[model samples]
Target chain A: MTVSLDLSDVTAHYGNTKVLEDLSLHVAEGELVSLLGASGCGKTTTLRLVAGFLEPTSGRIKLGETDLTRLPAHSRDIGLVFQTYALFPHLSVRDNVAFGLKQRGEGRAARQRKADEMIERVGLAGFADRFQANLSGGQRQRVALARALVIEPRLLMFDEPLSNLDAKLRVDMRVEIRRLQQINGTTALYVTHDQEEAFSISDRVAIMNAGRIMQLDTPEVLYSRPANLFVADFVGFENVIPMRAVAEAGDAVRAEIEGGGMIDLPKQHYTVPAQEFVLASRPEGLLVDTADRTDGLPAKLGLRTYLGRAYQYQCDTTAGPVKANGPLGTPREEGEIVTLIPQPEQCCLLPREAK
Target chain B: MQRRAHPALIAFAVLTFLFLIGPLVIIVGAALSDTSYLTFPPQGLTLHWFQNVFEISAFKRTMITSFQLAVGGTALSMAIGIPAAYAMARYRIELPRFLGNVFVLPILVPEIVLGFSLMKSVAVGSGVPIMGALLLGHALLVLPYCVRVVGASLNSFDFSIEEAAVSLGCPRWKAFFTVVLPNVKPGIIAGFILAFITSLNDVSISIFLTGPGVSTLPIQLLAHMEQFFDPTIASVSVLLMFVTVAVMAIVERTLGLTFLTK
Candidate 1:
């Protein structure tokens, strides 16, 4: 049976440099949670901490009510798949899959039987006796997945598991890993720098920056409604319009852009602070309006490029440069005076962060 | 496109190989000679010297002593060197450069000079027995190669495998045996064979260390040569070469000797 994992206020360091600062996360039973971030953002470090390679300086880590912070890696009973597919080079595929069983003092016949079953499940029926050296990269990935799953570990972890494969094989292996993890119903934590890889396979994705989770949500919510400026920018929000709330009108609030223009937004659509805030929008959310429009944020079109289904424009505004998309039928020319409007469905309002 | 070997390069390689093996060929030829003295071209073919090599009481006695020294020295060096090499390569020890340089210091000193120093310190000054002295000296002599070869392998080893083992329910200590040791098997075999051969063929160190009624085979053979310069010495040399070649062949067949170059 699988179990949930919880880390309460975990803080970790590499010597004097603090990599994680009182961070916490939880993965529910049989659920997949991905730690998605750039390098050095502590995603891999978080996985290592859960795997018992690094003990938190001050925190309580629990796996299904069993405290794991003080336990050694071997006693933690977690399965980890490395980026390099760290299979034992000297052992056969079946033997490598059975290594955990062997270490747990299982008889040879029992280990061999279970290992062979796992090998066949990963679609490596004929490769039971073959060593990792002879296997292809994709085949080796399957072997790694089988080995980690064979022990029925409480939690399974993957550190950039598909980074070594080619583009095609990476997608295939990603599906295989997700399917295998689901079929076994094991709680798992995945760490990856690839956003698409994370979003496609994870039940929830935690976007990380500077060792902290900026936002934790499902792919749909994260794609449409980013919680803050950092996550909005990460999820492809190109323009951040700084604004100040001026007044409230019935069920809507009136806010003025920092440089010019004012607009009313439904109060239910945004939660802005009392003073300053940000209007974060994807390129498609901010539309290039007709020249001479009255209720549009002021801008001067600098360049225009065709984007297959739409035309993207570079607009110079009073606050900063902005990239926005306009309809393909009406392409704006360079140096044309234009106005930009925000579409509420593709845009979000976030509170200005305290530095 | 097909590639062709340059004529001059081919000739150079042939000349270099012949230069290396010419002396060995002559020695083997002389080993089967029917002669009173060591000679390259034999007057006739005979196996008398091979039979004579078995009859010498000193040869039999010294052979056993030499065998003991080789096996004991190799075992002692490997037992110490494997862990020492692993620690140096894997750990963030203080002054890593200094520790590496210190382990390799014995090899830098001339063999005869080191042997003389050890003889004075371990044999005469300390009153240790001659066999004990020889065993200790031989172990010291081969320790450097064992550390060096195994250390090279450990340096390039993907230590993530060891971590994987630990994460897979194997204890840290057992991870070394089940994962690290098996992965670095080539280096261990290379180190062991190098130590064994060096200890067996060593003469300079044995000269200063051997005492009354206790001498290594090479030292004993040298004393025999002074009295009778014969084909029997050539036969003994051939036998030593055979053993070395056989050991190397087994290594080549098993894990391959490519790691030797590495």
Candidate 2:
């Protein structure tokens, strides 16, 4: 059965330093939500709060209709897969997977059967009799997942589960984890500092900075339309140029850029009194043309790198150094002058305070 | 095809090994002598002094006392040390550095000073019985070993396993018993053996605490040696050594001695 998790206006502190401030999130039933942020940005703390390892200073945590804010970790009926795997070193893989079931006083035969099935599901069938010390990093990670899932918990949580893995195994394990979660229809909260890993497996990613969620949306939406300058820059929007709004239309506003140029931006996409604002766009959103063009900004190319699939060019423009990607077939020289044009729909307008 | 070790290094290593264990060999040789006086390279080999050890009534009583003290002290120390070490290792106890130094202060103090301090505080000042004083002293003496060994074990332990158990529907205490205890068992066993040995072989502390009708084996042996110089003491020492070795072998068979070295 699937269960939803909700945390509303939660605030947590360690002594006098506030680690999480008024943080809130909701994970729909059977959906995987990842809290992605840099280290010490309170992503792990939020996961721990949901897993009952921490008690929020002021907030309400609910699973379906039941309140779990004050419940102890054991009574919460949640499963957590730690980054270190944290397998019981003294027990074999089978017993480690059966630990949660055994704690619930299940019969030995029942535990063995459930543990065996889960172990096979996690692709650790032959590792049942071996201790954790004998297994490789990937095998140990699978054991941790099986141990957490075998109990049929209401909610599942992971704290950087694949961080210890090698690059190749990390990709494989990410797919396996997502597949298992979907098949089981379990509500899960994953925490990781790696943005690519988070975007790969999570149904939706929440970008966090300074203990607050900057944006919560699908990975595609987050990449295309970021809410603020922080989310824009974090999600690879490298070109952020300051703009001044000259006039407002029905839904769009004409903004004056540096070097005597103008661009029309949708008013609904940014905050209102736009005295000082910034136009943000990803490198892929900008098109570079070596031939002279009247409708685009003039710039000199600095460095051009071949990224296997596309050519990345760095241009020295009035807005500073703007990076753009183009097709590999057309090679542009370093000192050549080029016209850089921004695709209107792919760019975002944000208030100056967001900086 | 392998390269040979230098002759001077080999000779130095042999000399170091002999320097460490040469006295034990002499004691065992003297224990097997049939002569009345203690002598190495005996004229005749016999087990006569071992039997003579059993004939003395005081030796038998003191041997029982020493066994009780070692066992009781080790058990008490473990009971007190596990929780102390766990708190120091896991919780953010206030004044942690100061508390750690206090817990291990017994090992740093000279044995003679510790014995005198215990005699003044627990035996004379508190007016406790001689046996109680000895038991308390031994417990204090061995407590540092338990804390240090168990603390080291807890340091390498991954605390998330305990958290996982708790999340899997086990209470905090049950999680500790099921997960933490089993993981740190090797250290527990090693600490118990070390504490037992330390309590068993204590002479300086036992000498000041021993009174009439209550004395440890080492104190009794020392008293016997003051007047008589014979091979009986050597035989007793060899027996004690055998008991220690037998205990160590049992430990090595069950939970390897690598934990003890750690």
Candidate 3:
């Protein structure tokens, strides 16, 4: 049940304008990889390329030993769950699930057995005779997933699978999809713009921008150690401070921060460059007005509001307005001078790339 | 709500309806006339002209020819138009914008011009006979309307459904037949009926391409009207009206007229 996909230097274009460019990533056996990006970032195009719906402008797509670049979509043996959950409006739930099996020329009983098995797997056993128009949105999505996965394809792809659902249903369905993928041990690729959805379900998440993969890593690493500014910004790093590299006498390099503030770069923690770089920090990594915290930088708090178990403060710092989330009971007022300290280990240094 | 009618508006509406229905009512009335001449008011009400129309072999032959041509023309148009519409809908092929214009340009050309063009192209260049020439002409004339209707339908269709099917291991052709074609059937059906009726009632192109012993019903009716001023042609006209109305009613029943307007 192991499946590995290799997309090497893939580029896709719509006429003269390129949609995906030199995109490359790999999903190990039975791993769920998510391509997370904003709209028009070529995430769907990459999924389509892997599914063989679109021919790459120039590249190779290898699934284990088979090169699927030239293969048609059906021959690629990849399952795709569409964003709209495109179930056949005319077919019964059972017939929709049986479509692929019948296409393979399976006998009547065999097809019905497989369809019934898949229907139960998706928790729609009793609704097999129901038409798609009679089902709810969640049930329709589950049926679409069953139709895609019933064939046991080499690769499974979901195109914004949970985007159409409400917030609560999205959370529940994403967990269910992840559980099903893991239980079946299927190699899956999930495309979505929701950062929380990508982080929650993916073993590895690839952040894309302008037809290129900016970074690919586990969710924890992507959040704490994004490779560039795009991935940092996309992964919810609210503050990206501008820094110029300076010489360190011994253990640390002195980096000149923007707005006349300076911070010593711990050589072990950061990737120091020769000239200039940017330091990225997530909102949760910044600590404000704590007695035991070291490296406290002076900042003016603008607004303070309680967010569940945390206090969200908008502070005007050397790096513009920084949004920092602190512990719920922390005392802070608007227009009050406070010292905000960022965790040294959690701060990510990225080489500057043009917007 | 009170149902009060404005006298002027009511009069205008009645006049418009009469203006539209006057010719058909007069023709139907003449079809039942006992007189040999076609007159607005019948001297005697009878079914004699209908019997005359039925007894004539020319009328029967022409009706059969028209039915065959219309059916063949519709099938041929569907064979070419459906796939062309699908391709235009899915793929960003080269010159599709231009191809669309080329497909619809035939409709803009007058039927007389199309008739002459078909005659010079097929009748002279390839040396096809009268049947071949008539079919070729009708297919060409009706193809653009089919493409326009079917293409409009395909435009509104969801492309993702076909992709979903293909990814489920159904081949592209199977996916098209199962997912795409079934969804677009309403439009295809409307286009089929429209093309059929257009071919059936066509006189300009049919008259030019059809040789001796191969006249269509409209051409036969025109020939009868010119040679003899009789109510028999009016009876034939009423029969043709029935055929057109029946075909239109079937189309409206099957696909709904809303498909046409959309």
Candidate 4:
């Protein structure tokens, strides 16, 4: 049966070192939510806490209405797919898949039947009798997935499960995992350091830093309107320039870049921060205006990199070093003077960063 | 370019090899001597001394007792040390480095001193039976190998697989039995074999603890040497040397000899 996972104000530590600090999350039933962050950003710790491997120093974890704060992992009815696949090397595919059933006292004949059915479903029908040592990397992961899913656990968790797969296989395997989870309608929490993987697979993504989640929202909103500079920067916002509002009209806002430029943006396209704010954009969003010093921030180009679709310019601005995309049709040479125009459609105005 | 050794260095290396393996070659050769007494060169080859080891009824009983102690002691050491090593390897204990050092500390004590201490504490002072006391001593003597070898195996194991079992609805301890135990089988078997050999060949510990009727095979061999200097003991040693080599080869094939270093 499916159950929602709720982690409320959980704080955890390793001896004196704090890992997750008063973190709270609620994953809706049948929904897949991803915890996205760099390595050691406490994403794995959060998954471990949910799986009942690590107890929280404070607060509670709930699966549906069940209080799981002190539940052992096996009793929690949660499945975890590790990056290593973690398949039992000694057991054949059938036995490995049937292990959970056997432990819960399922009869031998019954469990074997169920395990065989699952082996076939995961595309390893004839290979059930083969040992893990005989399987390829993809086949091994498929076994791991089938073993976790066959239990029909209340919640399924993935800890960078696709990180070990090559790029092409990673895409295919993620699709496979997502298909099975959908067929079962099990709530899942996925932890990954890859932004693309999270954005593509999850219904919503939580970007974490240190121990706190900076923002949790749909991938679209997180990409377009991140709540703060950190979240903005995490979603490919390469330039963050502080700006003060000079004037405002009904559908337009005129702002002055901190250094030496003026810009006008559509009011509906970007958030008008109540006070002085920071403007963030991706390299593609921060386009180099061909004009030298009009309608944008003044910059001097340092280095140019030819991206397949565009030539990216590393330009020095009074704000800091800024990377912006210049049109390949009219490439800018190094040491050339340029101006940067921020496209509100690809930009967001964030409140000052919280310390 | 490979460097060449000097003439003096080559001569010194040859002497060292002879010094190390010289006694073993002499014993193997003497075991085949036609003469009844144990003598090396100038003797016609015969297999009579090899057959003599199987003739003595007293020697048979001692061999039985020695085999029993080796099997029983190795079993007890594994029963205690596998779980203990698992704890030391898998969990974060207080002063883990210090605890690891203490776990393998039994090997640091001289075998003779350990034997005397065992006899004093277990047999005489503690009022234990002779066979029980000897078994306990052997188990204690081989515990370090059990811990070291099994601990090395457990250390290199991917603990995540254990967690995977736990996640798959296996109880924590049951997970250890089904998952952890089977994966580290090579190390466990290697450890058991090593401990078995140590118990089988133990002399100093057996000497201190042997009462009237409870001497081990090695103690009986020592007694036989005192009565007659025959090639019978040499034949037994050769057989044991071959057994030890076979066991070592099996361990090397299965777990790789580098596990000992681990």
Candidate 5:
């Protein structure tokens, strides 16, 4: 059965200091969600609260119709895999897998059968008898996974499970973990700091900052239509220009270019913010010119970097020195006058107050 | 033109070794003295003291008492220590720094002082018997070691395994037993054994708490030495040395002595 987790206004604290503040989330059944953030954003804290390791200071954690907030970790039927892959060093892979079953009073034969199946499922078919201490980092992680899945938990939480592996191994393990979750149809809440990992595997990525979720959306929406300036900036919106309304219509605005040029703003636009706004455009959306043209703004080219598949150029613009990418073999020279044009469809405007 | 080892470092090492083992070496040499005296560099070689030590009924009885105390103390300390260590390591308990200080204070205080205080508090006021008193004292003394060793192991241990167990449908206690406890076993065993040894060789506390009939081996040895300068004492010391060597071997095999040294 696919389990769904509902966290409503979950508040957690360490004595007087609050770690999580009025956190609310709804993870649909069979959905793979990631809590993405830097350190101290309460990402790990959220996972711990759901796993019953830390009781919420206030709020309800429910799995389907079952209230799990009051229950201890063991009674919650939630599985957790930590980043360090805390395998019992003394136990063999098979025994490690069998541990939970034995504790629940499953028969010896039944436990062994279940453990063997889990071991095979995690690709440790031949390493059943080997102690965890002797296994490689990837092998130990798989053993930990087998041990967790053996109990058939209703909900699974991964505490940055792939963060311990090397870069190449992390990518490989992320695929394996996602594949396993998909095959099992498990409800998963994965916490991680790597934005790319969150974008790759999560059905919904919750971007957290300062104990609150800044934005929660699918990878596409988070990248394309961020809720605020922070989310836009964090998602790599490169050039943010200040735009003042040229007319009293409010929507009709003009961005004064650094050199000598002005870009017109369309009034009564549905997407543009009405308040005093700053315009943001991604580097891929901005076009650079090498020679001076009548319609293009003048740019003092500083450096041009050949990036194999594309050209990365740094130019002095009205918004200060800005960086932008062009085609692979663009004939752009250093110390050349250039004009920059922004694709209106790709530009995002944020409230002027957004820092 | 050749570089020399640091004379001060070498001299300090030699002095430390001698300070620690000088008495044991003396007792070993005295065991072989043909003349009935606790003197090193014996005039003649003999095993008469070994024969005498074996024949002493008090020695046999006291050895049993000390053995029981050490074993019982280790069990009691481990029961409370392992979980306490885990709690300290895994959770952010209120005033953890204060609790940590309290746990280690027992080790810092003089053994004689702790022994007497415990006897007054638990034995005299609480009406605990001599055996109970000895067991209580020894357990308290060893509690700090158990916490330090087991707690240190848990601090360095990867907690992901416990999380894995929890995620697998195992309850918190079961997960701890299956995942956390098993991983910290080596540290627990090392701590337990060290606590046992400490209780075994304890003389300062045992001296004050020992009743008329119940006495630990170390107290018995001290009593025996006061009355006689016999070879039997030397033989008993040799046996004690052997036990210490065995303990060192076990510590080396289980949790490396390097950590203990630190």
Candidate 6:
């Protein structure tokens, strides 16, 4: 059965070193949410807390109507697939999948039948009698997936499940996991550090930094409109220029950059009121023109690279080295001066904070 | 690049193997001698001494006693050592290095000193029964082997498997029995055999603890040799050697002999 998981004001620490600070997140029923961040950003810690492996120093965790904050991992009715695909080496693939059913007191005949069905579903039907050590990495991953899903847990969690696979198999398993989760409509929480993996599999991505959630939004929204400097920088915003707000108009504020350039930002994007703000834009959001235009900032092109489908150029502007991607045409030579224009709606405004 | 060993090195290796196994060959040969006196390169082959081992009541009683002590000591050591090993491997035990040293201290002490100490403390001071004192000493002497073997297996084990079990609706204790125990079974079996043989072959400790009527097979054999230098003792020694080899073969067939080396 599908269930919503909610964690409010959760704080955790490992002996006196604080790992998570007042982290709160909610996953809707049958929704897949990914906690995405770099190493030591508390993404794995958050997943462990939700899985009942680590108790929060202060917070309440609930799955639907059940209070799971004080429950032990066995009573939480949750399933976790480990990064190493921790299948029991002594047990066969079928036995590994039936482990949970056996624990639930299922009859031997019934458990075997169910395990066979799950093994077939995961494409390991012929390999059921094989031990984990005999299977390849991709096959081991499927066994882990089957083991976790056979129990029909209330909430399913994965800790970098695809990280151990080869590059091609990683993509295949990612799509397979996403398809299974959708078909089952199971509430799932996935943790990963790769941005592309998180974006492709997750319905919503929660960007975490320094043990706190920086932004929680859909993949498209998070890419287009990050909340602050950290989220923008983490989500591939290569150009961040400090600006001072000079004028406020209807639903828009005009800010002046350090190098005598001005841009208008929507007022609703600002989370805090400040005279100093930061303007952030993705590398693809800036348009490059060869002709010297009146409405564009002048910059000198430094390095140009051909990225198969597009030409990416590094431009030295007043805001520092800005990266932009354009159509594949004539290669731009080094030291060529070009006019770069930031797309109006693609820019985000944030209150400047100490880095 | 690989090169063949020198002829001198091969000769040295052959000599070393003979040096190690030559005494056992002499003892087996003497056990088959037809004459009453023990002699290697026997004049004639006979199984009379082997049958004589069964006729002696003291031999039969001491053999049973040794078997009981080995079984009891091995079981006790495993019951205590496996959990201790698991705890030390999984959790952060306080002063782990110091505690590990404490568990292995018995092995480092000289067997004669350990025997004397147990004689004074357990036999004289505590006034435990002779059999009890011998069992306790054997268990203590073999505990280090159990801990070391089982601990090595646990060190390489991935603990996340147990956590995976607990997350799948199995309680922690059940998870341990069903998951952890099965995976480390080879280590347990190896440790048991090592401990059992150690108990069976012990002489110094059993000498200090044996009362008037209770004696281990090794101690009884020592006492018998002081009175009679016959081929019967060699026959008993050959039988004990056979039992040890049989146990090792069973271990090899079931769990592979690599566990012992590990």
Query: What tens-digit string does per-residue lDDT give for candidate 4 at B30-84?
Result: 9999998989872999889878888987688898999899999889888899988
The sequence of per-residue lDDT tens digits that candidate 6 reaches over residues A20-70 is: 999899999999999999999999999899888889999899999999999
Candidate 3: segments with Cα more than 4 A from true spot: A244-256, A262-276, A290-294, A303-311, A325-334, A344-346, A351-355, B1-5, B92-94, B124-126
Model 2: residues with Cα > 4 Å off, grouped in runs: A247-254, A259-273, A290-294, B1-7, B92-95, B254-256
Which tens-of-lDDT digit does each residue in B153-218 have in candidate 2?
A: 998888888898888898999989999999999889889998999899999888888898999999
Q: Can you give the lDDT of residue A274 in candidate 4?
A: 59
At residue A351, give the lDDT of candidate 2: 79
Off by more than 4 A, model 1: A247-256, A259-268, B1-18, B29-35, B39-45, B92-95
Model 2 chain A poorest ten-residue lDDT run: A264-273
Top model number, DockQ: 2
Q: DockQ of all candidates, in order?
A: 0.75, 0.80, 0.64, 0.79, 0.59, 0.80
Per-residue alpha-carbon lDDT of model 1 for A278-324, expressed as tens digits?
88899898899876764457889988888898999999887688998
The window of 10 residues in a row where model 3 chain A has the poorest summed lDDT is A290-299
lDDT of 3 by residue, A1-355 (tens): 6789999999999879999988888999999999998899999999988988789999999998999999888888787788899898879999999888887789989999999999999899799999988998899999998898888888889999998889999998999899888877899999999999999999999988899988899999987787777777887777877778767736667766778666666676666744678777777777777433324455788788887868888888776888776776656778877766767766777787776
Candidate 6: segments with Cα more than 4 A from true spot: A247-255, A259-273, B1-3, B92-95
lDDT of 2: 0.88
The digit string of per-residue lDDT tens for model 5 on A1-355 reads 8879999999999878899999999999999999998999999999988888788899999998899898877778776787888777778889888978876789999999999998999898999999966899999889888877888878878888888789998898889889888888899999999999999999999999988999999998898777777787788887766654444434445545433356555554424575456667777656786544533345677788877767878878666777776677566778877776665656666767644
Best by TM-score: 2
Clashing pairs in 2: none
Every model: iRMSD: 0.7, 0.8, 1.1, 0.8, 2.4, 0.8
My TM-score estimates for the predictions, one after another, are: 0.92, 0.93, 0.92, 0.92, 0.88, 0.93
- Let me know the DockQ for model 6: 0.80
For A1-355, candidate 2 gives per-residue lDDT tens digits of 7889999999998778799999889999999999999998999999888878888999999998889999888998898999999999999999999999998899999999999999999998787999988999999999999999999999999999999999999999999999988888999999999989999999999999989999999998897888888899998888877778788766867667765666555555554446778778888777787646643556788888988988889888776788887777788888888877767667777777742
Candidate 6 at residue A336, lDDT? 85
The better-scoring model by lDDT among 2 and 3 is 2
Clashing pairs for model 5 are A74-B171, A79-B167, A80-B167, A86-B160, A86-B161, A258-A318
Ten-residue segment with the worst summed lDDT in candidate 4 chain A? A289-298
Q: Against the true structure, candidate 1 has what lDDT?
A: 0.89
